[model samples]
Structures are given as C-alpha cells and as structure tokens.
Target: MRQIDPAFTGQPTNSKAHKAVDPAPTRWQYRMERLWLTPMFRAMIRTGIPSFGFVFLFTWYINDPVRIAAMIDWYEGAVSAVQDRPEFMVSLLRIEGASEDLQDDIQEALPIDLPLSQFRLDMGELRSLLVDLDPVLDAEVRVKSGGVLLLRVTERTPAVAWSYDDGIEILDATGQRVATLSDIESAGGLPLIAGEGAEKNVPEALTLIAAASPINDRLIGLARIGNRRWDVVLTGDQRIALPEDAPAAALDRALAMNAAKDVLARDVRVVDLRLPGRPILRLSQPARAELKRLQDLERLSLVNTEGTQ
Candidate 1:
C-alpha cells in the first residue's frame, strides 16, 4: 500500500478501501472436502477402481470367439471331472425285498442306463414309477456307496383269483388286481369268484365263501347274481339262492338244514333262501318225475280199494 501524509492530501485519497479479506475457503477446495467426507464416494474411490479394471481386462480377453469357446470348454471340463467321480456314479441297481419276476420287470422298465450319474436319477420319479406297478405297494429309492442305487419295496400278496370272461386276474386283500393268471390252477389255494361285478365286490364274496367253508370240497365257486346277490354254486349243478341282505346268515341256515336232513345231498336243484322263514326246494327233472309217478300210484290204489268195498 502506498501511503501519503495527511498534510499532502486535503481529506482522503481516491483509493478504494480494500475489503476485509474473506476468511472462508475457496469454492473448489470446499467442494473437494465435502466429496471426500461421503462414505460411498470414498468406497468407490478405493474398491471400484480395481474391480472395474479387472472386469474390463477380463471382458476384453474373453471377447474373442476362440477365447470364449476355450473358457466354456474349461468350465464344462471342470464340471465333468467332478460329476464323473466314482462316488457320484451309479453302476448297478440293487433291488431289495422284491421277487425275481418283479426285479426283472423293474430292470426292463427303467428308462435310464447303468453307469449314469446319481444326480441324473430323480428319486421321487423313480419311486412313483415303482409304486405304479400292480404288485408294488410302496417303494423307496436311495443312492448307496460303491456306486449302487438301492430300491426297497413292499409287494402285495395275492388274496383271491378273479375270473373274468376273458381271463383271470389275481387280487390282493383289498381287491387291487395284482397280476393276470395264465390258468386257474396257478392261483394256488385262493378261492375263485366270478360274475358281472364280482371283482368289485370281492370282500363280500370272500365273506360268503368263508361262511360256506363246511362244503368247500363240494363248492365250485360263487356267482354274483344281478351284481347284488350271491348264489353258492356247488357240484351236481346245484345252487343256494341267497338273499341280498344277511347272505351269510342264509348260508348258515342252509348248511344247518343240510347237516340235519341231507338237503344238499338230495336231488334239489336250488334251495331258495330269498324268503326269510320257509325255504322252497326246487327239485331236479328226474326227482320231479319220480314224485309225480308216486302220487298217481297212491290215488289209483285208493280208487281200487273203494270199488271192491
């Protein structure tokens, strides 16, 4: 500042008084300090730079067709190396609690080949497929050590032989069909039942057969009449017509009568138990003829004796 004596100048010089120096920081410096204080900005400055550089270099390197193909091949090769391990492969299927025939069926029905990766086998789908078989009640599938796939199952047992017109099918205790039979003798000792809807009412048929156990040797089979009633068929072409309700009781009554009066042993074609109290006996053709002849002979003897008197 150039100062002049007050005496030289009359009152004040034409010099602008210097404004009080401003104490605040410059605009650019303040903005830079504010940005540095922000946590996100600091983090971006520290980590984002290296991340962006590495990503850029990697993308540029893999942009070529050859390099891209090679990278994909390396990934696939690594995955194959892990998946092809012996522990991850299934070489043989071990079936437990299944018959030889059923095992054969499973082996033939499986959609996958052996030596496949265990990861490729859907356990839920495999179990469902096994349970869908007629004989399989339930099945459990699992992967075991030594590259084996184990299947445990429960098989249904044959309870009765259902004889339809076309063929016979063996059924379980719940009337579920198990398998078709080649012949009736193949049913072992299972009782045979046949009629319009006998297969549907197998439980009732079984009950009736059980009630007729006394005459099992003479029993041929049970015939479902009108899909509602049962007719106990026996040898000699005889039948016991049973009522719809209380059929077992009706059968018991017939058995009791036969035991006492030998009704079943006689030439009776049918014992009609449909009516509650009185049972009508329909005689065979030969028995009816002999009965009519005997009645005529008695009438003629009475007439001859009266004329002589």
Candidate 2:
C-alpha cells in the first residue's frame, strides 16, 4: 500500500491547506437572502422607492411660497401671451343708436386704449360704465368677428320740461332727468311742469294735458298746488283750478264746457273747479266793470217802464 499524506487524513499540512470554506451563512443572513428573492419583497421595494421620492418632493414644494408664486406668474404669462395674439385683438369700436354728441361722450367714457386684446377687457365693467351715463337708458355690448367691438345704446326720451329753481330740466316719462334746458321755450312742444314733486307725477300731468287736447295749444303750463292738486295755467294768465282726486276728469269737463259755452275765451282770471258741484268764475277787471254797468242800465229802464204804467 502507498503511504497516505496527513492532509488527506484530515490533519493540517504545512503548506497552506486548502482554506476552510466559509461555513454555511448564518441563519439571519440566510433568511434575508431568501426573503430578497421573493415577489412580495420586490414589489415592496418598487412601491416604497416611488413613495419616498414623492414625500420628499411634496415637502419641498410646500415649504417654498416664493417658488409657488413664481410658478403661478409664469403660467399666467404663458396664457396671456397665447390670448393676446393679433387675431384676438379688438382694433375698432362701432357704436349704434346713439346721437353724435352721445357718441362722443361714450368714446370719452370708455376705459380702453385702441388695439387692445379682447382678453384684456372686462366686459362686465365696461357694461356698467356705459349704463351709468345719464342719457343711456339701456345698453348692450358684444364682440363681433373682424376685431370689432359693437356697442348698442338706448337713449332716454324727454317727455316733459320741468322748471326748477336752478333752471329748466328735461325729464323722461319715468321722471328721470334727461338733460338741462336753457329755458321752457327750448323744450320744443313738450308740456311744462313746475313746483316740487311735479316731476314725480309727470305721467299724470301728461295724461291731463292729453285729455285737454282741444285747448292744449292755449294751455301754458301746470302748477302743482300744495303738492297735491294741479292748476292748469292758460294763455292770458288764466288759471283753471283742478280737484286733487280726479284732476284729469275735472280738466276734461272744463275743456268741454269751454268748447260749448266759450267760457275760456271770456275775460276770466280764474275758473275754479275745485268744488264737486259748484263752479266759480273770477272775472277780469274789465269784465266785472262791464257787468255792473249793464245791471245799472237794466234797473233804470225797469223803473221808467213802471212809472209809465
């Protein structure tokens, strides 16, 4: 038999014996390696990395207000640049249903510079400004194709001329002030109203004037008596006192009587129709003198006839 070496016999040899192989891994290390190879572990790793990255990014974003504001400004600027393009610009304004002077006033009141983008104009604010004008009763604004802004306006119509302490003012049917006039003559053919609270009853006064159409040309103006009733002033300084309850009806009756009896044509200072059933006439100085003279002549003639009998 051949002699066996000690190394082969499980004894250490002088030459570096084959290094003892590392012992099998520890239990914890073995378990870790096994767990790392599992599908669940891989999934957890994938999900946790993204979650951690998100947390860090979110925290950084919340801590910086200046950065957020800068981002917002950048977004607004980008959007504005897109909207302010030449195709979206409003270059001309077209106004309709306004007089020449009113058109000039509207142009002066507009808050926009020419050639501005529609996106920069606030339609609501522009509408409010237009409606605030004294002459503008109603208004409409629209953006048309071809970069034109269309403004349609409805102006107030003067229904009556009011005489105030300052001057004469033209009023619409609703008692709204339309414009100031130099005098009553400047009001054209509109009826005149005077005294406080007369403007509030313009519609009623106009109705009464309409009822007195037969004598309207001779009717001068209407005065609000004690702010309750109306006194219809006619030419030659004649006044017709009207009842407060139904002045229009009273005026119509007086006009009808005048048409039949020529009462208004007579030399009367005042025709008082204030009482319900009683009508009083205040004659002018010449009319009163002529009546007294006729009465004396009749009495003298009657005495002479009695003496002859």
Best by TM-score: 1
Which residue pairs clash within candidate 2?
Answer: none
Error of 2 at 29 (Å): 16
Give the runs in model 2 whose Cα sits over 4 Å from its true position: 1-69, 289-309
lDDT of 1 by residue, 130-187 (tens): 9989989989999988888999999998878988889999988788988998899998
Task: Score candidate 1 by TM-score against the native.
Answer: 0.77
**Stretches > 4 Å off in candidate 1:** 1-78
**lDDT by residue (tens digit), candidate 2, 1-309:** 998888789977765754556789989999999999999888878897789899999889867999888889999999989989989999999999999988999999998897988988888888899899888899999889999999999999988899978999999988888888887778998889898889999989888878878887798889988889899989998999999898888887888789889998889999999998788999999999999999999999999999999
Q: Which residue window of length 10 is worst by lDDT in model 1?
A: 12-21
Question: Highest lDDT: which candidate?
Answer: 1
